[model samples]
Target: MSDAQFWEMNPTATEILNEVKARKIQEINAAYTAEAQPLIKEYPLVEQQSWTAQNTEARAYLAWHADQQGAAPGTPVLDNILMGRNGETGTETLQQLCLAVIENAEMFTQFQQLTGKRQRLVKAVRAAEAVEEIELISW
Candidate 1:
């Protein structure tokens, strides 16, 4: 599914989309090709492949899009302080919310495939103490 659908599913993402996008970009380009890459506009080495280059370029562009669309408010975006009443101390981060949304029973598999973070997502879902506390039901 397109990234847009992800945001659509998790409306809470709007507040911290930058964090989510930054994270997703890293996941998308963890280990790209070295030299055998695809060439979309510029040029690659003689030993490079167009398909690989194109894929890398595309992923990077998507990452750039993620950056543009989902950058945090500051350099240390993850360090935001949360304050609420009724002793609600734990601050469910945007990444955590994204993971929760990704792991929702309705679209777990789709998000796993789309984000390619199956292990992390699964682990997070399993570790979350209050998945239900984070409301994803849009109305």
Candidate 2:
């Protein structure tokens, strides 16, 4: 059922539903920040060179591609070309070189585990899926 239908059917449970939704949003946000933000932040550093180098290299690549195509490098072509240079392969290539490097880096697994709060959240959410069930913890 749609959210509105559910709400209409169970107006009295609205407060509990809203609390669960709010908590889910908070949990997802926390997981994103903890697990994903740093990896995303490193994208520019890993994908492109420094500012000066980026500009110079991109311009050169554009000039070369334009010469070959006999037209100015359009935005899409520039993006593809730049991505190719970043990978030293076609735009659709898998296994970016940096990904392999990162995998081998001493910090990779630690970074992934620490940042991967979604795994933990998934387990918690799965357990909570049976809302009618009670869980007891032994200390």
Candidate 3:
């Protein structure tokens, strides 16, 4: 039912309903923040968002294709590129690359296309989130 219809059907429950909705908003925002905060600190905001978008893309691809596989999913292409570069364990290599991205920001021509894709993804995500957050605040 629509909001007006539902409210008419249960006039006495409006306060309770509002409270429940408010609590849910708080809970959802808290959950999103709790998961996002550490990564936000580690990368600049743009890179953190780029990583999230890249992860989501990779995960969706894996979900649909994993069982039909020739090879089971392994590390992401981005991780593989970094790993192959250093011959180190994945984490250290990725950390070093991320730090390099932050520090140099202009030195890696080979990675330029990959980084460009991430840059675009980050901009799009930020724009979309800005609109969503504005709407969420009205609730």
Clashing pairs in 2: 35-115
Worst 10 residues of 3 by lDDT: 130-139
Worst-scoring 10-residue span by lDDT in model 2: 130-139
Off by over 4 Å in 2: 1-6, 11-26, 33-35, 44-104, 115-117, 129-139
> Each model's C-alpha lDDT?
0.38, 0.48, 0.48
Between which residue pairs do clashes occur in model 3?
A: none
Write the candidate numbers in order of decreasing TM-score: 2, 3, 1
Q: State which candidate, 1 or 3, has the greater lDDT.
A: 3
List the RMSD of every prediction in angstroms: 25.7, 12.4, 16.6
Q: Higher TM-score: candidate 2 or 3?
A: 2
What value does the lDDT take at residue 69 in candidate 1? 72
| lDDT, candidate 2, at 138 | 10
lDDT of 3 at 136: 46
Which candidate do you rate higher for lDDT, 2 or 3?
Answer: 3
TM values, all candidates: 0.18, 0.33, 0.27
Number of the candidate with higher TM-score, 1 or 3: 3
lDDT of 2 by residue, 63-87 (tens): 5554666654334433554576767
lDDT of 1 by residue, 16-76 (tens): 4444444443443442222113211244344224333333333444454466776533312
Error of 2 at 36 (Å): 2.5
**What is the number of backbone collisions in each predicted candidate, taken in the order shown?**
7, 1, 0
